[model samples]
Structure formats: C-alpha cells, structure tokens
Target: MEFSHRDDHNNLSLTRFESMLKTNNVLFFDSNEFENIIQHYLENGKIALAKKAIKMGLQQHPSSTNLRLYKTEICILENDLEKAEEILDELYELEPSNEEIYIQKASILSKKDQHQQAINALMIALEFTEDQDDDADLFSLIGMEYLFLEKYADALSYFEKCLEIDMHDYSALYNIIFCFDYLNKNKEAINFLNNYLDENPYCEVAWHQLGLQFTSLKEWKKALAAFDFAIISDDTFVGAYLEKGKVLEKLKCYNEAIEFYEMTLTLDEPTSFALLRIGHCHEKMGNLDLAVDFYYKTVHEDPLLDKGWIAITKFYNRSKNYQKALYYINKAINIDCENVAYWKLYAVINHRLNFLEEAEVGYKKSLDYGNYELETWISRADILTNLGEYEASIINLMQAAEFYPENAEIEYRLAGLNFMVQQNEKGIFHLKNGVLINQEYQFIIKELFPSITELQAVKNIIAVTEKS
Candidate 1:
C-alpha cells in the first residue's frame, strides 16, 4: 500500500470511529470495515480499543472467522496462550482449510520459543494454502522459524523458495543474504545475488545486498559499482546513496562522497548520521571551519547525538582551542554522563587548560565510568603530581602498574613519584625494574624528571642498568 493513500484512509476511518464512539450510537460498519478498525487499533498498540472493536464486531457478525482469529490474536497478545490454543483448535474444526488458523497456531508456538513446532505448523499451512501467491508468505514464515532455531542453511533454502515464487520478495532476498552472512559464506551470497540480479535486473534490494557483500570483502570499487546499480534501479533508494557515500569516503573521494550525502537530504530530511559524515569528510579535507559548521548542524538537528558534540570538541581540541572544546565536551557529558570516552576527553581538556582540580575530578569520573586504559591512570597521576599531591600520584601509579604489569612507562613514573616523596628504596627498586623491562624508557625519566638525574645514586643506577 502506498503510504499517502493508506494514511488518508486510516485518518478517515479513525475519525469516523472516534465520532461513533463519542455519540454512543450503533456503529454501522461492515465485517471488513470492522476488521480494518480493529487492526488499526491493534497496530497502534491501543489494545483496549481493539478489544472493544472486537466485541462489537462479534456482536454484529457472530460467525466471522476473521474476527474469531483476531480474538485469538488478542488472546496471544495478552499472553493467554492456552486460551489462544483453545480458540485455534475450535477455529480449525470450523474451517479445516483456513491457512490463517495454522499461521496463528505457528505464531503461538513461536511466542513460546517452540520454533521447530512453528515450522511444522507453517509446513501444514503450506499444504492447505490454495493461492499460489500465498506460498511465498508461507515459505517466508518457515524461513523465519528456521532462523529462530539458528538453522541458517535450512532458513536460506526456504527463503530461496520464496524468491523463486515471487521475484519481488525483497524480504526473502534479505533473509537469504543474512543467512549467508551469518554462516560466513559471503562468496556464495555474492554468487547467488549476482545470479538473481541477472534475471531480475531491476531488483534494487539485490543490488544493495551485492554491494554489502562486496563491502564485506573490502572490494571498494566493486561495492561502488553495485551501489550505483542499486541507485539506478531505484533512484530514491536512500540506503544505496548512504552506502555509496561511505565507499567514496573510504576511497578518499571526499567531494563525490559529500555530493551523495547531500543528495540524501534532498530525498529525505537531514539526518544526524548524514550530517556527521559530511562534517567528518570536511574535517579530513582540512576544512576546519566547514567541518565545525556541519558538526554544529548535526547537534542542532539531534541534540541527543553524542558523536556530534564529540566531533566538534575534537576539532577544537586539535586546533588547541581548549575553552571551546571544554564547552562542547561538557554538553556531551551532560547528555551521556556515564560515557567513559567523554569523561576522558573532559579530563584531558581540563588538564590542558591547567584546571588541576576539575581535571582530577574528570579523570576520576572517567575511571568510575570503567575506563581501564593505562594512559588514563598515568595522565591522572601526572595531573595529581603537578598539583603537589606526590603521595596521591604514587598511589594512582601503583594501581596503574597493577593494570599493566609489563609497562615500562608506568614503572618509570612510579619510580619518579616515589623519589619525589623521598621513598628512596622504593624509587630505586622501581627504577631497576623499569630499566630491566625497557631501557629505552630511561629517556622518559630524563625528560619528565630532569632534577632526579642530578642525584648521584640515580645516575649510577641508570649507568649500571644500561651496561648490564
């Protein structure tokens, strides 16, 4: 159904339904109209209204098999599976040839995670289905049941059956691709889709799936060609445009990528994803001002998009504009306070601006949010040391050493912090271990703690470790 036509019909039906409900009159609707009304309520999650509609429908047409099936559906939705099964059994006796009865029974089984039984039910449904066009739907249902069981090969076989019956069964095609991808048979998927496209050359979905397979193989040029074919098959295929833009970006064709990304905005409303990609491309091309503009646009379009704020913050940080970076990063933290990366960036920016207290708070927040990186701990300790909190710095580095036992940099920093705190024996012990692990890290100590090099004992230790 076209969306506009469906929307207009639904609106008219809903308005009439509402008017009838308000007037409390005998609602004059045929069996099909009542079914549509009940279905609309069910689809919109207005379960109470759906129940009312079903009751009124049954009153108007007590022998409606469709309404009885819908009642069984309502029972299933309420998780009264036993009641639903009873209704399905009664309906089966009444209409032995009804495909909908078996389908509903399969749905109930599926709800209980009895996927094999669901497949059996759908297979029986296939036996009863008189319409050839309904075979595709039945095949797709069986495919889904097999999928639920993680039987990808069986699922793909049934989905392929569906595609054979209905060449326009894009859902079946997608399922086939999914099965192949899950089974790590991308090569087979590519071959299958290629063969399918040869017969159904205008299948945009098949072309899109072929493009995705090529992308998985890292064949950027082939992926682009497939995506182009998909776009040619369906000019308004947004997914093709987005994917083509991604491939262009991967190939470093920024200008062409931007054009495709911009084209999506013309076809549909501006999306944060598209805007963010455009900003990233501009940033890559050294257009900082344009990148910042798009990044701002992205956040304005969707304030909840943390990546937009992060991108803007990173751009300003790269330009050494600490204040602006802090502002944007704080916005990101507000949106997702538990995000570890955001807190880490906040800490780094505050440290750069020499806000020692705020930096330490941010660093602790990062750790609290599960940042296990050795660098985070090391940087936090450095900040503490700069604040004349030598003992605190030693404690932090000790924890860092535990996290990365073989890291020479952490050991060296631990040695320097111990020396600063006048723990000579501990300092010497750590220095020896640091040197033994990676003697090259001695340069870090020299650069970071030049005053420590003046100590004769430290100089002797370094010289002896180097010779050894």
Candidate 2:
C-alpha cells in the first residue's frame, strides 16, 4: 500500500491522511508495487488476501495488462478457469501484439480440457511473435500441451524443434523419450536412452526406463540387472522396486516378488494393490491364514478394494467356511453391487450354507447382470433341489446340459437328486444317461436307488412270506 501526502504542511492532518487512505485504498501503488504486495501475500501463505489484492489491483488499473494477468492467475489458482478465459479474451484483443497473453489463453484453455484449441492458440502465438528469442519456451510449452493430448507424433516434432533452438534443454530430452515410448518405437527409445546414459550414467529414471523396456521384451535377467543398476543409482526409487517385483511375478518367482513388494511398501505408503499381490503370493504358497490376513488388512485399509474382498472370500470358500465366505462376499457386493462376480460368489457361499432362497436370489442377480455360465445354471439347479423344487431343478439341469453336453458331473448330480426325492422314472432316465456318459456309475448305482433291483427280485417272495 502506498500513500502520497495530499497537501501542504499547514493542511497536513490526521483526518486528511485517514480520508486519503480510505479513498485510495492502496490503489495509488504502481503495477510493480501492487504485484510485490500480492507476491508477498502469496509467499506468506495468505492466498485469499493475495487474490483479493489482485482483484483490487485489476479493478483500479483496468488497462494495466500485468494487473489483469495477475488477476487471471488468481482465478486459475481458485480453479475458476472460465473467468480466467474471459479475462484472457479481453486482454488478447487489447494486446494482440503481446504473445504472453496468447500463451496465457492457451494455458487457460488446456485447464478447461480444450487441448486442441489450446494447441491452435499456441500456434497463433508463435505465428505473430515479434521477438524470436521467446520461441523456444513457447515451442516447449506447446510440446507439453501435445503430450497431454496424447498426440505423440506432434509432441515429438515440437520437442525436437525446441531442442534445435536450445540443444541442452532437459524438458525437451524427457519429452522426446516420452513420445517415443508412447509411439511404441522401442528401438529408437533404447538408442536415445543409451546415448543419454552414456552422458549421464547415474540417472535413475533412465535406468528404470531401461528396466521396463527389458521387461517388455521378456528378458527377465537383463531386466533384473537393469533394475539392480537403478536401485544402485537411487536406493529410494520406489518405482524401481515395484517394477522389479512385477518382473519377478511374471517369472513365477513369487517369493522373490513378495520380498520386492514388501521392500517397495517400506519405501512408500502401502497400497491395496501391493497388499493384494502379497496375499496372492501367499495363497499360491498354500499359506491360507497368511493370505487371509493380508487380504483382510487390504480390505480394512480400503473397503472399496473389491479384489481383497474377493480374495478373502475365495480363501474362506476354499477352506469350506461357508459362513465366512458368505460374509466377505456380501461385503464385496456392498462395495460394488453391479459386479457379477461378487454376486456369483455370494450365491455359491449361500448354496454351500444351504440357504437356498438367498442362493437363488444371488444367482439370478448374477445371471441378469452378466453372461450366464454353465456353473451358474448348475448352482441354480442345486439351490432349487435343496428348496424341494425338484421340477425346477431338473429344468435348469436340462438347459445346462445343452450348453455342457459332455459334463458327466452335471448329469450325475441331477440324477442323484432325483433319486433322493422318489422321482423314479426321471431318476432312472438321468442315471442311465449318466452311466452312458461315464461307466463308473455302477460303483454307487445300488446305493443311490436301493429299491430298484432288490424290490424287483424279491417282491413275489416277500408277498408269499407275508401271506403265509
């Protein structure tokens, strides 16, 4: 805030000073002075005051381009990009010769997700640039804009142009690598990176990128060596540990993967993905309790992590704890109710628990949402049978058999259930078909339908004995 005395020594008074202060309201300060005050407010972490000062400065000096620019920056900081664009539009028209205004407009457009329009504005900024010295910065910024748009070819061209203007620009070099990777030109990427490494061997990012490329090529040993070099360059590189763990997982070295994942977690905040992978490794090693523990930890940390819920539910089901299986399955469904797999798991656990009604509802929900698999139909049949709806169960089995004609297990289960409830003709037909499909039916044939042969062979003798 600036104050210039209003009058001569005889008239200088407290009342006059106060009146000047109230009317001027810091407006007497030049653009640079106001900007300094704004910057001081920002540096002191008084963001709202800084914004208010910027707005006051812009209102006081409506034609002051710098003041308007600062106000536009404040609008961007407050995430009111639409207002920023409106300011930029007026500024661009007033100062068409000022390339900075165009650049600011491009930035505001990019923030609003209008990337292509931002690029065109940047091109226009370049076309009317009276000063040649600022072209490199402008080109580099445009390259970044293209990169964000995923227009890799154009990004590469602009990045290369920036390097031609300033040969040692790090941003241009990094953008070149990114563009090559985006275009899947791995050979060129490797060449560029190798050259970069020759000049800068301690670059951890270069080593990590090389490791990723090796992993993509399935050269696991080389990938491991590259990641080791990366870790040596920067032991704190979390990405190196994570990528190494993933490569180990791909090589089927699950124990090594778990170790790497654990180390990565130590370097960064533990993620649900890492925890889930640890659970998977333990499950593969047959450490069921450890697997369940990790999965539970993951779910507790992030209830929206549907995979952890699925993993724990599968573990409980595998252990035949149908009640616990049902619990986690419902938790998963609650988190992602639209997912068919969660519903299927819920149905399966319910069926195992003999909660026939609940199981039927879950299976039907799954079928309605997703593809109807043979197992879903089979489970539907089993649930119906358990509910004493034998006819409905047989109907589902008949439909499932059409889809899985060679599934002798389906036929056997259907026949066994029919025989259990005294549906003799249907039981005989299915059992005979099951035997035709699998000749091993004789092993339990008599036990399954006890009266079929015994009653046929002894009915007359039993009748005579009863009469005598």
Candidate 3:
C-alpha cells in the first residue's frame, strides 16, 4: 500500500513536469520542484531533458546548492571529471559537513581508477553518516573499491561488515562468497557461514552462499541440505530450487533433480536454463524422446540459446544420426558463427560422414576461432594423413607439439607421419621419446599402424624401451 502511494506521487510529479515542458511553464516551478523534475529525468537516463531542467533550475535559483550539486553529478556522468571536481570542491567549501560532496568526490576518484583515494573519500563520508542503515551502503562501497583493487581478503572483510549491519544484504553476501571463491577459501567460508547461521538460521542468502561453498567443495549432500534450508526459509526462492537441482544432478540422482527443476517452473515462467537442465537429466536417464522434446522447448523459448541447439545436435550425434546432427549443428553455427565448440562439433560430424574436405575446413575454422582442444588438432592431422598429405600432417603435428610438448599421443602421431614420409631417423627419434615419456601410449601405434609394429627394427626399439 505504501509503495503504491509513492508510485502514484511519482506519476503525478512526472505528469506535471511533462505538462510544464509542453507549455514552457517550467519557470513557475520553485527550486525544490525544479530539482525534483531534473532528478526524475537524470534517473531515467534522459540526459538532454535533465540538462534542460538544470538550466531552468539554475536560472530561477542561481544560489541553490542542490541545483549546483546536480550540475556536478551531470558533469561526472559526462566524464568531465575536472569540471565535476571543481564544482565539488566549491560545494565542499559551502557545505563543509555534507556527506554527499564526499560521495561525489569518491565517484570521480573511482572513475579515475584511483581506488584508494575513492576509498578515503568514502571513509570521510562515513564520518558524516548518521543513519546506521546508510553505514551498510558505505561498507558495501568500500568493499567494492577493495574488489576493484583485487584485494579479495580486504573486500571480504568489508562485505562481512556490511552483512553484519544488514543480514538481508544479498548483494553483499554474494560479494563475500565471490571473494571467498577467489581466494580458494571454501573451507573457511563454510566454517564462517556455519557460525553465522548459528545465530541467524533464517538468513536465506547466507544459506544460499553456504550451499555454493559446499558445491565448490563437491560435498553434494551438505550442499543439498543448505539449499533445502534456504527453500524452507523462502519457498519462493527460485535460485535455491535451481541450485538444489544442480546438487541432485551432481549426485547422479537424475529423477530427483528433474523434480526440483520442475518445481521452479511452478513458481515462475520456464527459463531456458531450467529447460536445458531438464533435457540433460532426461538424456542421462536414457529417455531420449523426452529429452529431445525439452531441448526443442528450450530453443523455442530462447532461439538464440546456442547450448540448446548444441544439445540437440549432440544427441543426434550420440545416436549415430549423422545427417540430422549436421543439420542441427549448422543451425547452431548460423546463430553463433564465432562459437568454437560449434565449429568443433561441425568438424566431428562431417568427419563421421566421410566429408573429409568439409571436415578439414571446419577443423581450420575451429582452430581459427581459438579452439585449443588437443583432439581438434589431432583430428585435423589425421584427416591430412588420410588425404596422403604426409608433409602437411607432419607440419600440423609439429604445431600441436609446440602447444603440448609433453603429450605422448602427439609425439606418437608425429613419429607415424614422419615414417609415412620416409623420414626414418626422425621417426625413430620421436618413437623412442614417445614410448619413454609414456609407455601406455604405445597402444596408439598399434591402433594406427599394426603392420609397422611387425617391422624387426620397430620391435627391437619397443623391446628395448619396455626393458628400460
């Protein structure tokens, strides 16, 4: 009821402000009224109208400090930091104890990337802040400055202080969790949050953070319990439901996870993420038809969600329906041409269908788009070898070798390619190094070139290496 009244008042003010604008009667507005009008425009990002309002405001009340302060705010938004600081300095002189001047100074300093100076200004603002509720905001600002400086420990301390003042400060709680994650202090976070929950067991945000911390530690049961408590505290919390589903999925309880994911749909509109997870759970449970249905629903709801398309394509590939896989993957590629995973999948499907040239092109595209997976390089090299372009295959493997110097599979493949080109000495060198580095990878040679293993020289090399 109170919120509705405030909304009605704001609407009435906006209507009067617009009527005055249409008639050029804004001059009739007093200084306070003009300030309100300008603030409404500024808050809504109508910078031109805000400037117009400020002009009229200053013309009517040139001595108004509030109007001048709004001008400083406008200057700051425009990135005219020097002008903003000049006005702020004058405002500070006029209102020496005003907390807002210090906050404006902090904003300018933060924009300049002088985080420590911004923090100092906020500290000064804190001295003038009388409201305990405002102290939570001040602490959050100081925490944000420390975060910008990459001082995760300091940021966590300040965010914890903010949470102490207002336990319901969800943003501060999330920041504290982020800081803990950044520091790899999950165990510490669990202990600290457990202690906090001892006194405030009903803090849904704290319980949610504890669940996330347990998730990071792979303690699925504990994470599930934390999420359950969060849901108990606030049954409408969609985040808790989603996270509970994830923990169930992690535990390989697909049916239970699907129930939780479906619970979210009851509380809110079906999200693409929830739909995708339901599809994945069904897929894992061998309900391919149901999985495909949900996957199609996901894409229909959010056509631009590449994961949905990729999921459908991968399902087809797993079922060995190469043609359908190719068709859907092409659709995904059309949606996001720069996605390396899509290109990689495109290459794999093409390779399965024996479209060697197309597969090579897709592999090149994947690599060009920064696909660094070792399998991508190896698959491309294998295609080149199949085309009997042994020299090209060798060159490709050499680049892969540069990226993964200690990879035994790459070394073995290089040895095979060199042998195909009759580089006997080079083949012997790499073959020796590959077997010595990882003897298990000798199976790759058996799979790729069984006839070569029968060679007496190769057998001698293998025998000697095995003995070593």
Candidate 4:
C-alpha cells in the first residue's frame, strides 16, 4: 500500500517514474516514493522496471530497508539465490527480528530441495511473527513445507493451527482436508468436519468435503444429507448440486437426480457433466428418445467428451442399431485413439455389423492398450478363429490362460483349437484339463469339436472324471 494515502499521489509516483525512465532524467524521489514506484512495478509483473527502480532507489537512499528488501525479492524471483542470500544475511544483521528475512530464507532453501531445512527457517519466522494474520500465513508456509516432504500428518497439524486462528481461511481448510484424505482417514475427517461445522455452520466448503467423505464410505443416504447441507449453505455451489445429483442417482432416484441436475443448468452455464447425467437418468427411466437427445447435446457441448459418445453408441447398440453405434464410436476413437474402452466398443459394433477385418483390428488394439478383461481376450480369440487364423486363436487363448489359468472356458477353447489344427496330444491334454476343471462343460468338446469327443482317450477321460 505504498503511496496509497491518496489516489492521485499513487498515480503521480508511477507517472513520474516512467517519465524519468524514458527521458534519462536524474530525478530525485524520497525513499517512500521510490518504494511506491518499485512496488507498483513489482506488483504489475514488470520485473525489469522493478529492477531499474531498485538500482536508482538504492543510489538515492543508500540505507532504505524496504528498497533493499525489494531487491532481495527480485533476486529470489529470478533464482539468483546466492545474491538473495547475501542481501538477507546483511539485512538479518540490521533487523534480526524481521520475519520476512526468515521467510525468504525458507523460500531459498525450498528452491534448493531442502524441505526440512525450509521448515526450520519458517519455524524461526513464526517466533518473530507478532501479528495473528502473519502467524497464520507462516503456519501455511510450514504446512506446505511438510507437504513437500510427503509428511501429511505434520502438514495437517499446522494447517489446523491456521484454521484455529481464522475460521474463514478456506485455503487452510482445503489443505487440512487434503491431508485427511491422503491418510485415508474418512471417519476421522467426518468427525473433524462435523466439529468445524459446529463452529462455522455456514461453511459450504466444509459441507462439500463432508459429503465427499461420506460418498467414499458408500454411505449414500448420509452423503445425500451432507450435500443437501452444502446446498443449504451456498445454493450457488455447483459442486454440491452435481454431487447431490450423483448421490440421488446412486440411490436409484433417477428422476430426483434429473431435477437437481437440471437446476445446475440454470445456476451455471451448460456443462457436459450435467447434460451427461441427465442422459443417464433418462436412459435409466426408459425414455430412449429423451436419453439420446441429451447424449447428443452432451457431445455437442464438449466434443472431446468420450463418455458422451460412448453413451450414444451404447444406446444405439442396445436398440440393435449397429450402423449408428459404429458411427458414434468412430468419433470417440478419433478423439482418443488409444482409449481401451473406445476400441473395445468399436470392435463389438463392427463385429455386429459384420466388418470382420476391422473388428479384428479393433480387438487387437483393445488388447494392445491394456484392456486385459477376460471377455476381451475371448472375444479376440473367437474373432481370430472366424478369420481362419486358427494358430493365432490358440496363441490368444494361451495368453488368456496365463491370466486366468483356472477357467474351464479358456481350457475348452484351447482343446478345440488344438484338435482343429491336428495337434492331437495337446488337444487331448487340454480336454482332460478342461473336464477336470468342470465336467459339466464337456458340451464344449461335444458341440465345438464333435470328432474329438469320439476319440477313445477323450471318452475315457470324461468317463473317469464323471465317476470321480
């Protein structure tokens, strides 16, 4: 707030400073006026101007503490840590009780990746801080230092101290909740938030955090109550409205979820999240036309939203509209080429439309992208067999067997494919393995490869297994 006693005085300092810079005039200013000019440059992010002001201000007033402090701050911002430290060491000799000196020392230590040492410097700063608000600020700095050390419990304690000084400090409140969440202490977090609400009942952020904690515990009804309280505290809170909608949806109150979701549209701008939720609610309620409409709107509002395209494709796919489903899925794939879910759905749609080659490519991509679902493995194996790639089918099933060794279905598939390729010994071995896993699935042998069932070894194995 330098030169802040009057608006015209503040304007006059900046104007005269800039005029002197352009004219190369050796103009004189008092130490306080130089500070006002330098502060204006610093606050506006005009670092070069601030530096020039510092040089001139120092030459004019050789012993100004504020001017020297500003120079040290510039050095810190520019990462000239050595020079910054030299200035600070000099300043410390002058004013040993200056908290800003210690704070800047903490900043320099932090930049050197010395988080524990930074915390130590901040603790010294705390000893010198006389103002209650400055103490809270220093506490936040120490809490951040603990966070950088991955010491969540220590960070939480300091942030809690910050809240004790100023109950309305939202940043401290958020940091405290983040620590609780990182420690996975949901129950403890709920108790803490409940205590906080007792003191500051209208804190919507606390209520919102309480709701999220209850949601994580799967206490859906309790989460709904918490979100309701958040809305009561701040009706315009978009996060509360969205979370309430989700909780209602989880409770299968689809229509009620839709009501709250629509309210969000009026309170905020059109969001793809709200539109997507409304589409899901419509789909759950069997309103197919309305469901598709909202899904389309979801994609239109946010073209990169893959879930919206997926919803549209799923809706059409369920209606046996293979072509429509494939069209929407293509859009999703174009946006995110490596998305496993998109490629998996693309394979399903293309297979339904009898595009076997492209369907096989899609399945291959889904597997390549880490979609290791058992169904994906079997589906790709089946597609390989259809394309007359029997050896590839065997290899696919063998890989799946590695992931799911005890599955009788994969064992049976391996048995049939091995026999189809005239690998008789492997076929008989897999047949016995499959029957031992589940004799009820011998139909896999009899139905898919009937000739294998007629073999003496196959019949004998099944007979012995059934008796056992």
Give every collision pair in model 3.
none
Candidate 1: worst-modelled 10 consecutive residues by lDDT: 1-10
Local distance difference test, candidate 2 = 0.77
Tens-digit lDDT track of model 1 for 326-387? 99999898888888889989999999999989999999898888897987898888888778
Which one wins by TM-score: 2 or 3? Answer: 3
Residue pairs with backbone atoms closer than 3 Å in model 2 (clashes):
none
lDDT of 4 by residue, 144-205 (tens): 99999999999999999999999999999999999999999999999999999999998999
lDDT of 3 by residue, 1-468 (tens): 111355776566657767877995643567877777787777677899988878878888988888988999999999999999898888888898888898889999999999999999999999999998878888999999999999999999999999899877779878988998899989998988898889889988889889988898888889999999999999999999999999999888999999999999999999999999999999999999999999999999898888999999999999999999999999988889998889999999999999998998899899899987898899999899788888988888898888889789998888777777778789888898898789889987788766678766678888987787
Per-residue error for 5 in candidate 2, Å, reads 33
- Candidate 2 lDDT, 386-451, residue by residue in tens: 577877777777777887886766776666667666766666666556666765554443443344
- Measured on C-alpha atoms, candidate 1 has an lDDT of 0.89
Task: Give the Å error, residue 224, model 4.
Answer: 4.0
Model 1 clash pairs?
A: none
Q: Which of the two, 1 or 4, has more lDDT?
A: 4
lDDT measured at residue 399 in model 1 versus the true structure, 0 to 100: 80
TM-scores, each model vs. reference:
0.77, 0.64, 0.85, 0.78
Against the true structure, what is every candidate's RMSD?
Answer: 4.8, 11.0, 3.7, 4.6
Candidate with the larger TM-score of 3 and 4: 3
Name the top lDDT candidate: 4
Report lDDT per candidate. 0.89, 0.77, 0.88, 0.91
Over 4 Å off in model 1, which ranges? 1-20, 27-33, 43-46, 60-65, 78-86, 89-99, 367-371, 381-468
Best by TM-score: 3
